[model samples]
Target: MPVLEVRRHTMRSKPGQHLSQQGVTLASLIGNSTGPFDLVWTSEKPRAIETAIAMGYTLTRQSAALGNLPKSILDAVAWPNDLESISKIVRRNNACERFARAQAEEWRSIAGELKDNQSALIVTHGAIIELGAIGFMPNATYSTWGDAIGYCEGFRFSQVEGLETCELLRVPSHLQLIHN
Candidate 1:
């Protein structure tokens, strides 16, 4: 079985939407700590591509399934309308949940297709990797995403065929403490 590691792209420059110092830090950390991967994938986004390259992946491929939730969906979440009727709210919420579940299933299918002894690395966004993939993670390892997945944070899964549960290898840690 191969292990699949999913990472969130680190901080990006806002104005130009490029990699930031925090992003560089994450790339350097991964390059120093992790072993060489058999396959590397990044979401079809510049920030994700930059993160993968900085992590020493010279031949990273783009996987749309590993990208962020759709912009319109994200916008809805970020700025939800409080004026919506009950039925409208229910429909919107259900739609978003369905989309997240689909994303998780897609990643699971991708993981199942990996050959033995092949480790796959993915660089993606927080919403997709954090919230979307939470339910797929081992219950013992991660009960919930719970805001632990900050910028560039991620988790690793031991991907075995027919396994509904996976072994969690790493839990993202804060590179710097947020509180005094």
Candidate 2:
């Protein structure tokens, strides 16, 4: 099966648009164990692009659709909510739902382009990752998914019988740094 590993950008100092030095270190560590990915993608945001570079991958493409969401959609859902809360907003709010569907479709489109046994990596933001996962796997057990994804945390998606299945990806506890 083709695989897509989508992860949030690593840590950035507050009020900065780029990754911190420590973020580079963390991403490098994570990259060490990760892949020889067939393709790599990122949001156009500097932080997302930097994360992929730090993780030792070159950009295959960057998309505004992956990073930019309208202010209306941003206003409709609270930032930093848990998966279940975001999933609820996705169901009731038209803007959120539309954005979520777009995210899901983007993931599918990327995965569809991969050849058998190939894998891809996408580096994006927190809410985009969460919404995409929920959009792609609506019936998943959200409550067990805990809080919003942290830096370098996201999901791995694989298609089985034409349906997508997702699993959470997390920075190992030993590698997690305390953010001030």
How far residue 60's Cα lies from its native spot in candidate 2, in Å, is 0.7
Q: What TM-score do all the candidates reach, one by one?
A: 0.73, 0.93
Global lDDT scores for all candidate models: 0.62, 0.87
Query: Which candidate gets the maximum TM-score versus the true structure?
Result: 2
Candidate 2: pairs in clash: none
Candidate 2 residue-pair clash tally: 0
TM-score of 2: 0.93
**Per-residue CA lDDT of candidate 2, range 84-119, in tens?**
999999999988988888998998898888999999
Q: What ranges in model 1 sit over 4 Å off? A: 75-92, 138-145, 159-174, 177-180
* Root-mean-square deviation of every model: 5.7, 1.6
The model with the greatest lDDT is: 2
